[model samples]
Target chain A: MKYKDYYKILGVEKSASADDIKKAYRKLAHKYHPDVSKEADAEAQFKEVGEAYETLKNPEKRAAYDQLGSFQPGQDFRPPPDWGGQFGAGQHFSEDADFSDFLHGLMGGRFSQKHGGATMPIPGEDFEVAARITLEQAASGSEIEIKLSVHEPDAQGFPRRVPCSIKARIAKGATQGQRLRVPGKGGKGLNGGRDGDLYLKIELAPHRLYRVQDHDLYVDLPLAPWEAVLGATVEVPTLSGRVRLKVPPGTQAGQQLRLAHRGLPKPHKGEGDLYAIAQIVVPAKVSERESALYQQLAEGSDFKPRSHFDLEVADEH
Target chain B: MNIEISEAVWLDRAGVISMSELAQLSGLSEAILLQLIEYEVLPPAASAAGGPTFTGDCLVTARMACRLQSDFELDAAGLALVLSLLDRIRGLEAEVRGLQAQAPRRPHKA
Candidate 1:
């Protein structure tokens, strides 16, 4: 097992007073708390700090840890041969104790008793995983299989992470950032305690054809310049399927053509709208006859796109 | 490989869980949960036939409160203050995410 320097973890001196140790722990805990901290590994850092404080805060555990002598963190070492004999050797640690093997060897049965009596019922630890699904899956419910590495104790009562697989059905109308609770799927409870729950945070993967804003869906509807000037019926894609939409004459660029009740499904309500934003596309290449026709139209028509610019310049002057 | 079909509930739905269920799921005592409710750290979504019911988000908050209470030996009032601050931070983070999503994406300069 690797040696861990508890004092170094808490950033306190080996001879620091209990109050100083506590103050250090509080500061670190505040900085590294998973919910509060934005650090990428805040949860892991918080657990390490908590484990260090768990041992150092107690008088007996600290004394016992001190007797083992200091070593470099992560240096491979085992407890002294007589170490178990000195501490409570015959006592068994709790199956749910998640402390490091080093602390488990040093503290013995004292830690288990402090948490709750060995026979006392302790609930299992909850697990959370962020699951990403496609927009179609959110529109229509889908089944997903999730593999989780759950921390469990071996037959000898040593902590180990065992791989667990679970299959869950995400209900339809589930929105992005929704939390789905799977009961009795988390860590196993101890001493007849209730099993913990698993929380799956639903994330919608970006779609190639659509952009989602809440339940609304947006898609770029490319139209020919003539089609924008003349009315036409165009086929639009919805989550369910394709539908024919009427594009009115004189449709401008960036205009949203709303198709009601065609977007994502909302729980306990009607579906959201699908908006097709108009984009007029001009032909990049044309035949000689088409170029001549365009030139004739350009000379015949007195359309001025820069009229707004001229007006703004005149106003400024 | 064998597949185990699990029972799941959406947390955002109103009145999904009771106070007792929340207490059990959070590994906190009912009395402690009551104290948190009294301090408004966890406000129930609605009152059910049996008692007040909470949304799924309360479970996360309740678990956090349990840990903070044990780790820092904080009272209900202190936990309330900390929880309120955490809620504000989450709100600000969500607002920032929304704003970023609305902002136009610009190509990075090499």
Candidate 2:
């Protein structure tokens, strides 16, 4: 169907040595391996690199590919008329083989032969997908539905995409980035092999009021200036509900008030703690009478906030 | 569209799986899995009443080792070393994410 330049994909010359080709493939594989790589579209790049290396590593396949001559990548081109006679014919490739039609046409017969012409029990492929939930859901377990597109081989060994819908219950105390497994829920098995598993990676959606670290939750507790000065019982929001928290007299800004066992639940044992960070707020604008009262207080009070600045200046002098 | 409903199992919990189950899930043989266990790559979680058992996390690690070994032609020791390095990288990534969450956010402009 389309031409793909194996040498160009591998970043090697046509005349490059075998060792050079192998080295290039290794470097690219390490950089793009789906499990370890942080790059987007890493799985696609890895499949492309793997397909290119598969063809180039074998001398026979490489020779046949070289004889087909070069064309621009993705250019619509067909193999020569007698090409099928030189290589084995009547080999069909599935749409989801992850290999280009050109490589499949050139080497499909060898793949069949590599399997020894007998139907071997091939295990199903594992699938991984991300599942995003809320912090509240993580505290209390929730039910979720997930969809997956799996490739299943037909009677002719051509794989077709099969859409799967699974409903599962996420246990309580699930943390961010945790992986949950659904056994035998992945791609179907071939030749009586067992079905593969489905892995769901838990991702907690950002909460409007809370930030999570491990199981601990942190929330900002905004207080008025007078409320910070005098003791008050303020209502604080938690995952379960709201609770009244006592603000001691003269509570400082940025102080953390810990609410024991108010955070997310642990898997087996105790629950995590929640911290309410204090933030003192003042009125943006004041009336004339209030301003006069403030002026009187400012003159009456002897508190100097910039005392450290004068001390630092004197030390420098 | 095939709709299949099922329950999920958390790997980090105390639920343990047998060695044969691990081999079947990972697509590796029992002998090779034993060699990996000897290298401390796939450590058994505990010795259950029946026999030695592994946690569900071992299934993921074993599958990764199978793929890496086949793709790179690595030995048991080499696969173990790579797996350890990958674990370190994952730990660092989680730590970074935690720090980013704790960092104070800048005020939004109106």
Question: Which consecutive 10 residues in model 2 chain A have the weakest lDDT in total?
Answer: A109-118
Local distance difference test values of all predictions, in order: 0.78, 0.78
True contacts kept of each: 0.50, 0.48
Task: Report the lDDT tens digits of candidate 1 across residue range A1-317.
Answer: 67789999999999999999999999998899876788889988998998899898999889878877878997766555565445544434444343375365446532333233477766787888888899999898889889987766555554555678999998777767777789888877777877888888888998877777667777778888778989789999899899999999999877889999998897556787888888787777888998999899899989887899999999999
- The residue-level lDDT of candidate 1 at A248 comes to 99
Say which candidate scores most in DockQ: 2
TM-score of chain A of each: 0.79, 0.80
Tens digits of per-residue lDDT for model 2, A119-154: 666566688888999998899988888877665544
Mark the regions of model 1 whose C-alpha exceeds 4 Å error after superposition: A84-117, A224-226, A229-231, A267-269, A279-317, B29-32, B35-41, B48-50, B68-74, B88-110
> Once model 2 is optimally superposed onto the true structure by TM-score, how far is the C-alpha of residue A38 displaced, in angstroms?
2.8
Model 1: which residue pairs collide? none
DockQ-based CAPRI category assigned to the predicted complex of candidate 1: acceptable
